[model samples]
Target: MPQVNLLPLPLIASTRAASNAIPGRRLRRFPGLYRWLLPAALLALWQAATSQHWIAAQVLPSPYEVWLTLDYLATSGDLWLNTAASVQRVVAGFAIGSLIGLVLGGAMGLSPTLRAYLQPSFNALVQIPVLGWFPFALLIFGIGEPLKYALIAHAALVPVTLGTMQAFRQAPQPLIEVARVNGFGRRQIISAVVLPAAVPVLFSAFRLAFTKAWLSLVVVELIASSEGLGYLIVYGRQLFQLDLVMASVVVVGAIGWLIDRGFTLAEGRLLRHRLTPGARP
Candidate 1:
């Protein structure tokens, strides 16, 4: 027998349509189109402020002037040189920090005794801000690449360690039991079940670590380095070239955005298998 249609036809059809809609797909496909709106508005506001003299030209150069400075820096190779130095520092420091963090965090996660022994000291140390370590770092490493590397690595270590420990600890007990029931060894269970579950969290940790390392590199450069993006900013300020300072800032932000986007893409690819069937790419 045919089922009675109790609901209104319009409501039933609308519900069906809504259920089948793929909003996330649209968002993924047109990300730039949507994401550029805020930046565009800000640019407009900046231009308006400059034209209206609401901000002094000496303090906040026009966008066109900043663009010209950026072009000059790029053409003269200054921008690339400074940027490359900063990138190299970030890579070296982040790699070392992340490796150490993973080892310590994994050990702590797998053993309650180690966690109890280390966590208190770790928490206490991490409470000290990055700048607070500058004096000690200077005494130990001096005003050189070693100082930059030490500081950047220290900035990265905290987030990665915390994220790794929490991720492993929070892994589903049901999954672990299932693995054990299947005769899996500790290593096998960790490799197949625990790591996969922790991938998303670890990736988030990497993002945070990378950002911190990048910022720390800049701060270290500002304090002691003769070259790098941070130096360019300080140089501009010393010479009263606000446009140059702004240009360096713009480059820094763009590079950071690109790095973040790269990590996001990697996370999506690495975790694709864990996504729901209808999840966006």
Candidate 2:
């Protein structure tokens, strides 16, 4: 035969069409561009409900009213003060908990005997919700800043411990063996092989721990605090100022979202080497 083509003409045409379908495919490639769609729709619905009197104004303030209340809080300086206090507690707790978790998890991962001895107790303890520890924490810490620190620390510790241990356990055996074969010492192997491989998991663990710590701080503030974002929410509800309550809620969510985005950016910067070429950060 002078020429032969195995593929069908329709299949080749369809493949070319898919390759050239930029306008139709751009949305799928960059879905993040559409994230605001749902929020915008919800806001429109909320405004409509408020204008139509479908929901009582007293029960659910308009978004504009909530914005006004947020402005007042900001200008009066209560918002910054509460936010700073919460951030302080989260920082202190997360630092202490992450240190302890790293040490414990490293020990367990390195020693089978240690893991066997501690795993059961750790598992049992983690099953109890952070709120369940509140009474004991209150009794021990006396409803002070220490109480918030302790609860946030507890919330942070579990995820970090689990993540570290799993990272160690799942580290590739071949790489570790190669390190040893190349005359690497224990420290060298850990620094060059183990830690590098575990970076992604460790970052994820830190993110989870940070979230847990923040949430625990809010709960503790709500239950027993003189000041913090959580206290603002409680105070607003107590005064039946739905606008204040909504404002505080909005601020809390926005802060959490910003913090998460910050972490994601940091992760992308620190772990860019692990990402494939041309991938989105």
Clash counts for all predictions? 0, 0
Q: Candidate 1, residues 30-104: lDDT per residue as tens digits?
A: 877778889999999999999999999999999999999999998999999999999999999999899999998
lDDT (Cα, tens digit) per residue for candidate 2, span 1-281: 57887889999999889888975588779878688889999999999999999999999899999989999999999999999999999999999999989888877877789999999999999999989999998899997889899999999999999999988877789999999999999999888887778888888999999998988888888889889999998998899988998998898889889888999999988787567686532
- Identify the candidate with maximal lDDT: 1
Clashing pairs in 1: none
| lDDT for position 61 in model 1 | 98
The 0-to-1 C-alpha lDDT of every candidate, in the order given, reads: 0.91, 0.90
Model 1 TM-score? 0.85
Each prediction's TM-score against the native?
A: 0.85, 0.87
